[model samples]
Target: MDPSQQKHFAVVDYVIFAVLLAASVAIGLYHALTGGRQRTTREFLMADRSMGCLPVSLSLIASFQSAVAIIGVPAEIYSNGTQYWFLGCAYILGLLIPAHVFIPVLYRLQLSSAYQYLELRFSKPVRVCGTLTFIFQMVIYMGVCVYTPAFALNAVTGFELWAAVLATGLVCTVYTTMGGLKAVIWTDVFQTLVMFAGQLAVIVVGVQQSGGLSEVWRKVQDGDRIAGLDLNPDPTERHTFWTLAVGGVFLMLSLYGVNQAQVQRYLSARSEKEAVRSCYMVFPSLQLALALSCVMGLVMFARYCGEDHHTSFLATSKKDAVVIFFVMDMLQGLPGLPGLFIACLFSAALSTISSALNSLATVTMEDLIKPYFPTMTESRATYLSKALAMSYGLLCLAMSYLTHLMGDSVLQVALKIFGMVGGPILGVFCLGLFFPCANSTGALAGLGTGLAVIFWVGLGSIVTRSSGSTPLPSSCVANRLAGNSTVILQAVYSNVTLSRPSGLKRFYSLSYMWYSGFSCSAVILMGLIVSFLTGPLKEEDVTPGTVYPLMGKLLCFLPEHLKKKLCCVTPLGQTISACQRQPPHQKENNGEAFHRNEELDSCLPEEVSLPLVEQETFV
Candidate 1:
């Protein structure tokens, strides 16, 4: 297992993964055994409404950062540079939009899944449709989140790919299944620290090995790898400001606001205000973390291209493997540093897995299970929630077999799917919030059209193209012009094939930054048109009785009707508004009160009543 032996036979790398995998297993098993019947909906999923801001924020960072950032961001930096990080500013915006807008709305509604907002804004079928789509998206993405790094770990470290994917997937899935949000949040806090330390270790130790930051910068400058702030127009280039900012803004909207994994963290906050604050904190942290990783990528590239550096990237199957390769070969000297670095890799995996599982479970109970099981008691819902989490995790673990085929790593693949799904998803929400003319029928039509467009963009000819028995690597002309490489480096590079092929190759560039943009535009345009043609997507008619949350808050005035609406304080059960009690004066005006009572009754069914937040409908 000597890292010095060959590119993949690194003993230190294996030791790192092995130790972490063991720890994951121990954690998952411990939670399962100790968790017991605490598997109820509120406790298992949302941590019994007892989560604080700081830990929740830390967990939020971990849950969203996942293997995609670990593999994709560094790979992106290796290919591009710090300029690509301009997208982080867009991410900051996405994070802020949700904190100020979406999170508060959801907290007021007190729904489980964001898609439940779809119900409020659209219709029953639309809610179910959105929910199902989310499930499909989560299944594939959770698989990628688990599979990608395991695939990379095995590819570079010479472990069994199947075993690696399974090993990682099983542990993440289990703890998420057992401990729910609490486990994910607590474990994610630890993992986030691990991930940060790991990246810092690579940067510090890699730079030192390559002489110093000065040498690294010199190599980057000499190699012409520093992508200038070329704000000018370039239709042909992949990572431009236009695409990065607009595209990144859309990506953030889908990723941070709409995506269950990212949004779930906010849902677990102590209060709506707390949720908003935690979300606000997430983007800044994400920006800083990504910026640091991008810096580390430069260090890795410097080592690989240095005059003294003998490593050959031409020998590797994927250029994205550079960071991992550097760790295994170039930066192996620091004692225990490798172990910490490896631990960070798991942090990425665990954070993402936790988010996906928790979100999946939330959506399942809120959207799918709640519909037919109207009589589902709080106790019953809780039981169903844990079972659903564990079951879905197992399904994904089985699907990890496909992980070996996804060599592009997690970020690129996730973005590809997210673009197709995320943009439209965000658009659907936008239609709900902004475009009152939008209706369920139009929303449905727009969703289909948007998905179709993203599918065409992301998976070109995957439909018309016949399914092949073998996977051949794709070939593309290496754009030395954009990357600022020498004329000689501009030669075309082809996707290489191992003995195995993915038959599922994408013709698009691996740059995930553009996905959010493509999706958002398509969905936004299509959704608006569809809504305009049909009718108002507004859930309630504009009248004195309506509760206009945003406008009311913005105007610094709560509507008289809304203020008069009865607020009932009840125990956690089938009734909504566990926090407020019904006053005698308010009880007299029972019409508005009855609407919420009906909504609460819907959640309780004939089953046990769980503590739920109040429900309000706005025009």
Candidate 2:
């Protein structure tokens, strides 16, 4: 807190940070100058659909794992203990469902925008609505992502917040516009590595400086900072196993399953298997990222147990800045470490912002613009896409100011934004994919009702200022210094039992973690009801390849006639075989032979088929 304790960057530190920007730009320039030279929308928006699994998987991780996760996750662990780590449990289904379910459907459709499927299954209005909703979510989210590192750096170091924001935003925009999705994906690969390196450095140093891992463990244990499994069923109880593992699935679905940023990556993959493989690979990397963040927080707690190092930032209610403060305090004498961490922070931010800008451009051009102007030239479309990317990049800078006004923790804020907006999008996709009977009217009503309900809950939570359960105590220095290793302080200081809120206030008290699942359920439930009330869509009317036969497969144990009665659809295998029985000329005429590789079909489900009629019905 004193002037003497203020941390300053060394010459080498600045070099490292500068090099990060340079490398990112260089990557962009490389892609821009070579390989179609960003002259077509195919190259600009979808990377020519030739991306491999490795880069796509890494880019997928980099997409959502922004600066908020970099700094905010550590701050969360420092404040609330390791219970937040349980979110790692969510990644299993989060990545799996997207890999197996969402990827195959979207990939097979051979569509440019993920929302195109909305139009295919529902209507053009639903597609436009979904696209706008996604744009809204990403614009707001990228603002937070752009602001987080800059705000943190400005708080702990003397870095200019707006300058940093402008620098990252502009650099990201230039590269994203020039290089297209290839540059964005490859830069993401590089930046993701830097992100991991930065987090790892802090943990290695913090663990070493905090005596050793054992000592660090002892201090955290003594301070009661180690959280056990909390199995609370109360929806308002934040970070419990149920909320994290189960509720987290929907969160994952919202992001990985249906979010445009991730779906774009999936669509860019060379094949459906490659996309699925990339999603599978995300599991371990995500777990590692989660572990590093959680461990960094523990090490920080161990090093500064019972210390006032965090008080200055905590007093101002800048909980997000606490991690930056801890990093500065620990990395003071270390020369390049601080800069490397700063680079790590910005890399995370740039990766996210770039992905958002590109995807925003993709959806804007593909869903919102191209359909309305089907006769637009490719060159004109590419130019507009680049301009859209640049425009959105600039817009995110303005959005950062709005983020600055919010008081919630950055991680919570980011996840809540994902859930509140993304949940409904995921629900619409789910309604169409799993429920063939859900009509366009139902999809629209469901989407509207879901958005309205989630906004009410999300805004209510914000207005009520519903904080998480009491945090772990922040004092253990005396006991550690006095060689009292066995002493265990109470985890939380609260003793009074307060009465729970009732009615609307009780509903408002729901955990932010449950927002995705809760809102998604609202959409599905409302959608089915609305569909039945209005005439449910007949199986024959639903677009082929749009309905995934999820219900028929799930209810496969029933008699064939009974299954048909309930699911109201033909078996997937029968449908695929029936299509395969058609002659090559018939297949060509019908456009039902999108993939000719029998090997690839063996790898994916038989249900992964070409559209029976691609444009006529939908367009």
Candidate 3:
């Protein structure tokens, strides 16, 4: 209990941390030196997009499951309950849509940054708009990734939060900047093992400390602490069946599927089939991970529910320290246990940050930079890409500071930030893939309107949160008046009174799970109708052939019933045309087709064609 006391970092802790850092550096340098001409934009950006499934899939898992899943989930469950795990099923569903829909679209056309699709689908402005929004989303998310683990370490070891944030952030930036995606994936594979070890260790030891499964269950039920399965249909009531399942679907879909940070990993696979397999594998693994983490949380609360829960600095200090508390207290003398646990947390944290940095750089360099800096030199591009990587990392740091300063539930904060922009972004992608008739003008207007509408809907809730909005519903008003009993008059004046709690502030709040669903649906509906009015992009406007294949998938025209699965129908319904020519393109990228460097083309997805696959050259 010494306020001035410091938990000296054991030698093993230093050794483990040092080894992880050194290994990450070694991975980067090895790829840099050995990946022939890999130091160029071709190799640095994508690893040639010829990597097999295992490493790619593993990287995807490590990226998506960040330090948040490792540390944040347990912290959340320690306060709330396993209701959070209920959303994991929804997350799996959400993730599937992107894998099936967006990745296929990107593959057929071949795009380095998914943001480039925006330009091809709608117009140049739409591409820039989507890219900018994605940058914001990635920056905030990456910031959270950095902040969370540093926050966890600060809690256990007694260090300054800012210092910890900067230290880990700067080190993560080194490999990300130097090595790009190759460094990110190799390091992710390493971090994945450490993270799995750490999480499983805590779950094992915490369960043992809480007696055993039967005793733990008995204690939880005895304490009435098992908050499981509550199915209500109200969107206003955040954890309701509607919000968690539906809204959770949109949130996870946007995150794991369409998210550039997530998609970037999948595209690195040797083939589309391999990438699909990776995502399919992650679905069940995620549920198991969530179950384990939540079980550990229940055990922690069962063990130390009423202990003097004190934390030094995190804004939401109460439950935020739960995981760290459990580790430092319950997990005592296992030799190198703390070091392993810390590495696991950092691994999760850094893995996400690694993807964020590379994706941000990829998007900026490919989508944003190519537009404005047309004369982008490779050496300068690399230099600028690294600078942008650091810039986005720094931006996340600044935003994380503001997030802690404002005070928010970590889960709520993450969802809310993304929800603010996810709708329009998802809408743009959906329009590109599903609607053949959407043009640049329509897409732009639709994106703008969709964003404005969701802001008012979601952020408006915050107003009613502070002071009840005008014409508040009777149920809401009644709910407010019910709290009138808590009001009290000061001893000096019996008549002059005001409503209050022991501490009067915005205590009642909405859950954030519904944010993404609401925004996405709003945009889809609005964008579709708007596009219908504005007319579809002419063959000249958008690069042709992009829409036809995507439309075929949406309509189920690539006949799965046939042997080849590429059969077509004639105007005479009885006659199968047997023609699947992908609707002759009016030249997809014809203007500068010959001039564009074939070397850059080889690094792209289109380079992995049928004859090449038949040869099994890179696969």
Candidate 4:
């Protein structure tokens, strides 16, 4: 290693890092001891459903904002420019829809796993399919989460990679198994603070060391790193306005709307209102997180402008480690800063993996194990749940070994994984909630078809990195020694060429941002078509609680005759009448009523009502 690239840590730096891990373990032990003498699955999985909005909100952010985003976002900005920042725009619809639509439906059901909705809406097979898909997705994702920081720190700072991985895996597993959801959420709260503090410290010190914000801004601008919205409508464009804003909404929906990790948080909230408020709270903090990473990239670009570290000791290091290299170099004189940054990275990884372990255990017990063992005792189930948590922790550690094989930017890789798997899952939920006519067969077919399409595209893109997108300009390497400008100009011009990819290659190479949107649309389209052809669901057979409230109003704009054809009152054991409107209190017997018919208008025709015999039987 080049002498300049080597980083040395002081005792104070080690102390700072140790304190973070100790505090997290302490929090877990506290929760373990403080809960009732006997631990229940509810206490372990849902925090007994007694959590406030603040902790849940913070924990939600911590769940998704792993070290991948912390390090990858900056690396993305540093390499590809700030065009990727437009993903922030998608957060608007992404979270809002979950707050109103997903939160209400799942929270009311009091589900232990989000896949429970699949069984309620479709069949047990569908639920198992959904649960298995989520398990595969999270298991693969946890490996990447655990591997990112350890690999990066090792590359840049000579930290022991296996040691870091084992420490994080063991610590996360201990807390998740010992303390459960309460420990996960509260530790996430503390880790979130540490994450922010560490990043903020780096950004503050980086700006000062780089000769101030004005100089940094000027340098980045000169290098053409300052980006504006890419208004191109091309789906093949990597990071355009439409892809980031519109496609991002689908990605966010897949993650925030239906993913088990977030669904668990929603079910843990004290009330429906609190759950919604917690989602709303995510906006500001998430934006701040995005901004901090972007600014960190700008400062890095400014400091390293025109300096070719690629030819230095870091030539063999992964791209993700570049951020660590710059940080250690900039903070060398300042003891403990590097350690804080490492803590931030590990903090991000640990929080995310801990959440994953707890949620995985919840789904395994609720969706898989408990269903088969209906008569099993609660104490035995709780013990089994803890065992499942430990098992997943081990699995995640094993998965970390595979992450070394992944190609492309880690941010894009993570997003691609979500889009490929999560898109179909979201589509299944959408079919259940938005289209009451969709049956189990259609849902199963749609999920299968969607997954097939996304994997085809995702795998093709990985195999051939010729995505037809324009390559980013090389990093600005400062010419420290006096050099010939003519030689530099000749070398740059020599690399300029124009070539177009084959049509099929281009199609397969469509921007990853469109993966979720395309897959979701494929599922919905295939599902509806298959459902209609294979005998659509009867209104009497549909569960009222499974349908979203907005679906009815969305169809209300149609003509009354058309509305009658499309909309029918779901059978809930109520009396049938000839298009008679009922008062609110009479219609909804209690809070269990999924739909609040505030309009009190008869929207369906008389013929839509089920016979009295069938109505009683359905109830």
Name the candidate that leads on lDDT: 2
Error of 1 at 5 (Å): 4.6
Global lDDT of each candidate:
0.63, 0.81, 0.65, 0.80
List of clashing residue pairs for candidate 4:
306-476, 306-477, 306-478, 307-478
In candidate 2, what are the lDDT values of residues 1-619, reduced to their tens digit? 3444456789999899999999999999999999999999888999988999999989998987888888878888887888888999999888878776787678776677888888767767788999999998888888888887888788777777789988898899999999999999999999999999999999999999999989998888888778899998999887899999999899889989888889999888887778888999899999999999999999988888866744455545476677888887788799999999999999999999999999999999887777767778889999999999999988998888777776545546655776699889999999999998887778989999999998888878767766456676787633344444444332222222345667787888898878888878888999999988877766766656677777776777898888878885553322343244222331211234322222222223444443445311211
Candidate number with the higher lDDT (3 or 4)? 4
Task: List where candidate 4 sits over 4 angstroms from the true fold.
Answer: 1-4, 314-316, 405-415, 468-471, 474-497, 555-562, 568-619
- Residue pairs in steric clash, candidate 2? 306-475, 306-476
Model 1 stretches astray by more than 4 angstroms: 1-37, 233-236, 306-314, 405-414, 461-512, 537-601, 604-619
lDDT of 4: 0.80
In model 3, which regions exceed 4 Å deviation? 1-9, 306-316, 394-415, 462-511, 537-545, 548-619
Model 3 scores a C-alpha lDDT of 0.65
Each model's RMSD to truth, in Å?
8.6, 6.9, 8.4, 8.2
Cα lDDT tens digits, model 3, 1-619, are 2444235467787687768777887787777666554556656777777777777877888887888778767766665555667777686577677566565556544567877667655556787888888988877777678777776667667757887677667767777777777888988888888888887887788778878888777665655555556776644564656667777787777777578887787777767677777777777667776787788777876776434434532223544554775676666666567777878888888888888888888888887666666666777776677788778777767867866776655545565666668766877777666555565666777778778866665565564453222211111011223343535324325442333212222223334676566666666677767766655434334444344244333445445554124322111111111122122332222232211122233234433223423322212
Across 421-484, the per-residue lDDT of candidate 1 in tens digits comes to 7777887777666554555667787778777876765665333332222211111222235554
- Could you tell me the TM-score of candidate 1? 0.78
Selected candidate, larger lDDT, 2 vs 3: 2
Better of 1 and 2 by TM-score: 2
